[model samples]
Target: MRDTLRVQLWPLPTLGVALAVVAGVGLPRLDGRIRHDTPPWLRDYLFGGSADAARSVLAAIAGSMVTVTALTFSLTVVTLQLASSQFSPRLLRTFTADRYVQTTLAVFLATFTYALTVLRTVRTGEDGRTAFVPQVSVTVAFLLTLASLFALVLFLSHLAREIRIETMMSSVHTAAERTVRRLLTQRQDPADGEPAAGDPPAAPPEPPANVLPLTPGASGFLTSVDEAALMKATVEADALVIIDRLPGSSLIAGTPMGAAWPRTGEPFSPAARSLLTEAASEAVRTGPERTDLQDVAFGLRQLTDIAAKALSPGINDPTTAVHALSHSAALLCELARRDLGPRLLRDDDGQVRVILRRPDLQDLLDLAVSQPLRYGAAEPAVLARIAMLLRELAWCSTPDQYPTINAALARLRSTVDAQNFHATEHGRLTELTARVDEAMAGRWTPGRTR
Candidate 1:
């Protein structure tokens, strides 16, 4: 929760509030103390007008700030709504997390507060008393107003660019790439880290003598699992834990999360059970929706969902589906170069404590082509792109991964064959599938046109 609050853009406004308080209350007070030491030009520029004039300027800026904030925020919400209807609602997180939008809103709101704060400190110099003008502070407020106008322009331009489908694909693709990097770079074990991308998929560990049922405290999609924490708990309890749910899976309350097998073949003691439950619950985070942070399938699913939506009869947009496919194919190719297959988790003493369940090369390969093939069988362009995606994945995969890739290709052919299309379109799709199969079988040269 703490991490979410810090990273999520909503809480950023509170930071703006803090900044506004300082600028509103602190700056003017400081200026009052150092009024005589300020440069003459600065003082002259700020205090050339009467006290009412200065107060009027601050009041005008403060009022304008409110209008600007409202206009920008409304524009953002409207853009998001339009984008969601045209693209996908899953993209809401991407737009909301935009640093530029967040900063723009924060700065504008703070500018309003600063002007109001300084407005209170304004005083007329009509009396015999020396002028009490907050020359520097008022000047800074004017500068802030100008900066806010510039930010408004930036926000509008960014919103227009972000609403485009291609931009959303690129953002989602970059996020998936980051998730993959974290998966590779954040390995907890040196032994685990040393395996090559070509290593055989690790065999499933034998079932423990007795499986201790672990239940979840709440319900949501299991987005991430803390492998290191789970491994530590397993070591402390002297047991082996096997996860029942994958990262992209939804969960129900009190469901059997997984089973724990004791190393000594003893029953789970009360203390051990409590420790396991707490660690398991904390180690795995559940949220309303899936994120690419740890769940590899989540990212692939986003692309798949968008493609599926694009292929719907109401939309009938094959080009968007192909655009999404390009990223999905590239991500699969990137996955081909890394080892994210299921494997053993051994503790410091080399005692296997947990067996983690992660999507392997085959799972991704299936995801990369299945949805598009299913929804887009009749669209020659979509099928052609799927065939080409399969070819690229096949070309990049390890020698042993060919069978799985071949199986996926077979499924793509079956999908194309099942669709009722004009004879010419069917023949073209069939030809494309046959070429993809040949490429998978190593008969086609690398970089050959599909």
Candidate 2:
């Protein structure tokens, strides 16, 4: 009860006193004829030369005005302070430090002075036998002033609340805009033609026939070729022919003898023999590196799969998928760098050069494919074939030759798409092409002119 009263009394008293004062002074000033027809009894009570009564009346009015004014000001200050606590501390400080409080106080004092003057005039007018009190006008004016002050307080408070809300909304808007911009610009994957960072892993292909039997010689590295004629052609064109000798015979290192060219050839120079030996040794020693590459490729493939799944018709997890894709790409790049070295990794004129003469290119490609497959199943066969083509192009002598490889891969991809064979693989192969293109274009730049 006390608390409720405490809260109510301050505003109530302020209103009452302010009304009384404004009524007393303003009414008579606006109406000049208010001093006539004063009642005899009221005149005697107020001003029939009774100085004590006048002094007592004056003192009562002053005391009431002072008490109400002080209470109102204190309440206003306290309320503002509490409100400030609820809002931003900085705003509260500014509001409190403003001249609003002082202005309110000044208005209150003016009301008190006006009331005193009007009351004194009424008493004096009664003694002089003239009408002084215009009760209706005085009451109306007092009520209007009180109403205005209340309205003003309400208006200001409401305005402050709106400002705060707007500020909060604006901040939220800016943050959202910034996030969208980053996703659109900096984080997108130019290669895959999708937003960056949300790609699924590529699925693994079934293990190919491990034709370890083909290369029986301990020093001869054997890789099966579907086109024996093509393989022979390549060997002949490059002047690095591979000759197949009798299983039990120890052929000279530099002798050129194969199914295509049966007779044993003249021996090579010591340096050439040493180079072949080194190449054979490196190939044999690549077992651990191949395993590592396989692992990395498997991981990449999985990430690509996730990205594809996220982008599927019923799914909507693009952001998550994109993040995975980015991570996988970064890992793949690192692995490539470790195996192939920095020179081969550098993007140069829309082509990724993998100098096959260097021992690490095979390891890098193996790893790249392995990582992708670890996460999911392999892409379509056609796509896989296209990727193989691209990998082969990396062995080309010049960067300009990449376009020919790209065109061939594109045709292969189109054929696979048309056939609807291994749809997922086809899509993955397309994505791989895009990645190669992006890599050739440098970090973020896309659209390979070559």
Candidate 3:
């Protein structure tokens, strides 16, 4: 829900408009009282023009503010277009979630709303009423116009910086790092060959019979699951439920999501099967798009997309791809140090009640490395970064993660072998692969490689 609000452009600006309406209405009434208390010298600061003059001033401000607000919207749309075209479309969330852009829009719209609201209060002595001008209210609108101007300039400068490839990549890296830290826990070393504390025990062997096949209630991207509710249902039915889809996975209606079986190794009665199915439907949420709420691979996917887009023939920007790889390397190494796999939700009695399938190290490696390796094969720089990424992961990975790291290393090596590189380039890559070997063996040798 928070992610949804952050990625939207309306919430902040709507709030600003609401507040502006309140202020625009209430300030004019306050102006009637405050106008009498104004000191003679202070009168110079407040709007002292005639009612007609006040109308013209407010009218001009209102007209110009409307124009400025439209310009801001146009520029924002153009920026979104450029970002989507030049970079990956997934990056649109970053720009939309930006506080600066939202604040700027909020200020501009509030100014326009305030000006129009206050404009209606300007009165001339034509309808048997005394000439009246809310001096303080007019002054406030003028001040808002000035603020809108400054915000416009600052917003333009900010937009310029945001469109740069480096800025967008850094923003993605930071967000992905936050997701990694939040969702994953560091791997704990086992003592005396026992499973570490906080780690779920191995799942029981599959039951020979009485498994109930489950399907999704709706079709869309699986965004989140209500684990607590799912667990409650599992405990009530006395069954073990396994969810086959992760947060970023797509689901089709009436398609198998996973299975549930009675914990007693007996067939599920019709009532139990119906209860579990309803629970699964309500507990699992599908959305039009994926979020980082539970998906660890979403960030890596975005970074990889950026790299792949950079390596496209039309873009042909290998440097950006290499830069993106550097970001991916940091995230992959972080994941390597963390415990990852399917999540087991246990009941109050310590019985494993729910099984949620999640991406493990190998899955993440394939996500972070596969596409870049495919598209960036001919570029020596991109290849070197991929090898360096492997070496970094090797140094940080646990013993159990060695196989996955080694597999990725092999893929990198194969890609390099297929490339028609100069002798010096291939030699440098071969040496990097050797360094990766040393790192995997806990014998990281420090030396310069040419």
| Winning candidate number (lDDT) | 3
TM-score of each: 0.91, 0.23, 0.94
Q: Candidate 1 on 319-338: residue-level lDDT in tens? A: 99999999999998888777
User: At residue 278, what lDDT does model 2 achieve?
Assistant: 39
User: Which structure among the candidates has the greatest TM-score?
Assistant: 3
Q: Taking the tens digit of each residue's C-alpha lDDT, what string does model 3 give over 1-450? A: 887898899999999999999999999999988888988998899998899888898888878878888898898899899989888888888889999989998998898888889888878979988777999999998999899899999999998898899999899889888988898787776667532233533754464455787778899999888899999989999999888777799999898888898888777788898999999988888888877778888889888989999999999999999999899999988887676888888887877888898888899999999999999999888888888888888877767778888898999899899988999999988988888888887776777642
lDDT of each: 0.79, 0.39, 0.86
Could you tell me how far off, in angstroms, the CA of residue 359 lies in candidate 3 after the best superposition? 1.0
- The candidate, 1 or 2, that scores higher on lDDT is 1
Q: Model 1: how far is 380 from its true place, Å?
A: 1.3
lDDT tens digits by residue: candidate 2, 152-199? 575456445534523322332233233223322222233755323222
Superposition-based RMSD of candidate 3 using all C-alpha atoms, in angstroms: 2.6
lDDT comparing candidate 1 with the true structure: 0.79
Assess the local accuracy of residue 365 in candidate 2 as a C-alpha lDDT between 0 and 100. 37
Model 3 regions lying over 4 Å from their true place:
39-42, 189-210, 448-450
